[model samples]
Target: MTNNKTILVVGGTGMLGKPVAQQLKVDGFNVRLLARNPEKAQKLLGDGFEIIKGDVDDPAALRSALTGVDGVHISLKGGPTEADFDHMDHIATRDIAQAAKELGVGRVTILSAYAVSEEKADTPESRSKLKGEAALKSSGVPYTIFRASWFMETLPMFVQGKSISLIGNQIHPLHWIAAEDYARMVSKSYQTDETLNKELYIFGPEAFTMGEAMKIYAEYAGVKVAPISIQMLAVLGALTFNTEWKGMAVLMKHYENWGEDGSPDEANHLLGAPATTLKEWCNKRYSQPVNS
Candidate 1:
């Protein structure tokens, strides 16, 4: 149960998880990554990292993965939320916490979002993730919750080919952070014990309204897009499960009117730099090809 390798990365194959695991190894921590699909994990494998298949709900496998892990980094996302209110999101927290405790793991850092208790947990993913945080709090593992803002990379989806939805007049001062900045902070959080047992809000260096974000996208991608509000029954359907980014009710509640409150002290303190805004990230996203 003890070895030089002492970090378990759940969902290491994900866009964020892959970089996080890689950064951990570079920092001289022995890292093990758990993935359900070895093939996906294989594509993202970094030097000196180990991959194991895992199901978060399975108590035994979760415990096995935690063996000798000084802490756990959970990038685990998705769950059975079809009419069940994020079945895995809420349940997996308890399961993960139990496994970590059983394996004697002390610290856990999991990807969380800007979920207020009042926010809409109407879907399986949202509700489940919310519950998972509560479970971790009661699970007895010291934890750092990264209540991250929306990722700038997901902006393309909002365009929807040539058209885009302009809800709230595109005037909502939304906040987003580049995945790279978040990954870097996650690395710093792991190296610094000061972050242990605290939940932090992370966002970009500047707050850009939805309209501004779209303007950046249209300009950078060199595509023409206009804002139109299609407030119909279809919008309601869109809200149920968002195929496009704006459709999600949570996004509407948390973001569309999210406001420009400015950056938190910790956003500058722990990360040592503010998050990269949508405009800044657009430069990174379009200055080169995705494969590059």
Candidate 2:
């Protein structure tokens, strides 16, 4: 039972976006991707998707990719700089919304952080995301904004070779969701009009603090968990000009300041709750034999 609807996925080659694109294909939608590197996307996605060579920065590219698509799913991420966030998260999103509106696209779905709100839009990324959400809302295109919790997939990022560094006093409990579950929900959103023009909060089955989550990951990966202060990370980032370090520091601080907010009741009731646990995700992720 294949649906004839074509869905264009922006950021289809990314960590989260990849799964969403895959799930959309699995659910029988005619999947398309607007990729900056067509060859890379073809390599990553292989055989099924219609890969259009384009970048989000190009309005013409956006318009071209959006043409004739029934729905578009945006899963973009920006950098360690305010300018980067403004350009990618805010401006690019605005451009896409405008193009979708003009092309008469059926629906637009986007992934957003759980804590992103106008009042808590202090950070550059948060502010930009808020603005982007506003852009889609004002564009008169049917949109679904998924405010998602922390992903279990991000745990591997903390591992530096043999050790895992836990940054900041991240005591906030987060409903760490899995990319696979989130992807399924995103695909499901396009199936029904009930999800259109709505903002949904996506949370996992269990809640765990950053430390607790890392502990689980550390044990599974056979690595030691070490604490790193946020200030120290910031200093290290400044000294080395490491954008990833700086970005992590900023993100940890943001989460520490404003923990996960919003209820996942609506999303759960509508699209079914996320069933994957961190331990379960880790087991599957690390199922392959590793060198000791």
Candidate 3:
């Protein structure tokens, strides 16, 4: 079925955003991308998408992108600093919602973390995400907030050369959803008005601890998993001046403290549950030679 509606995607070039943008196009919606680098977006997304040169930071760019669009999907990620999260996640989402409200957009969908809550809004990222969700809610525009669990795709990130590092003693059993599954659900949400103005908690079919998931991935990639203390990671990050490393340390610590809350029954019933298992994902992802 073809959708006559046009949807503008913010942060289309990111790891998670790319799949949703691609799926929206595959689902027959007129997909437009608001990217900071149009050429890079074109290179990654190819033809078939309307690539607009702009980012969420620019209100003029956001206004231009929101104009005449049926909906806007926001999938943004911010950094190691508190200011970065406040600006990129919170401020950008607020700006986008305001623009969508002014333009009379039909829907606004955003990606959020499952752990985000008033009590758990201790970290900058978590606080920003919670504030962002509130911004969309108060914007008076029809909205869908996808509070999703951890992604299977992030497993590969733990691998550094032939060794994989486990930052914390993450005992929580995560419903590791695939990017494809999340993207499919995002597209499906746009098809029905019933999904509008609701916060959906997306989860995968199988549950596994971070260590368990890493074991499967490590076996496939011919790597060994080693436990690295959070303090050690922080030290390494500080010594190497790598913000990503420091950020990962902070994130791992957060997850170690808080487990995934809320039920996925609503999201599953509405948009279909994610069925991809860790082994299934590994078979598809690491079927060939390991990259790293």
lDDT by residue (tens digit), candidate 3, 1-292: 6879999999888899999999999999999999888888899999999988888877788798889999999999987788999888899999999889988999999999999999888788999999999999999999999999999888878888888888889999999999999999999999999899999999998888999888878888888888999999999999999988888888898899999889999999999889888778888967853534
lDDT of 3 at 276: 83
In the range 107-142, model 2's lDDT, one tens digit per residue, is 999999987887788788998999999998999999
Segments of candidate 1 deviating more than 4 angstroms: 1-5, 79-85, 119-126, 164-170, 228-230, 233-250, 257-263, 288-292
On TM-score, who's better, 1 or 3? 3
Task: Quote the lDDT for 107 in model 3.
Answer: 93
RMSD of 3: 1.8
Candidate 1's residue-wise lDDT over 1-292, tens digit each? 2236468888777777777887777777788877777666777684577776777866667777888888898886563234343545566667777778777897888887764344556545666777788888888888998887667766676666665545445465556778777877887787678888887887777667777776667777766656544454237656665553333543454444444443446755876665466666777768832222
Give me the overall lDDT of model 3. Answer: 0.90
Single out the weakest 10-residue window by summed lDDT for candidate 2: 283-292
Clashes of each: 5, 0, 0
How accurate locally, in lDDT, is each candidate? 0.69, 0.91, 0.90
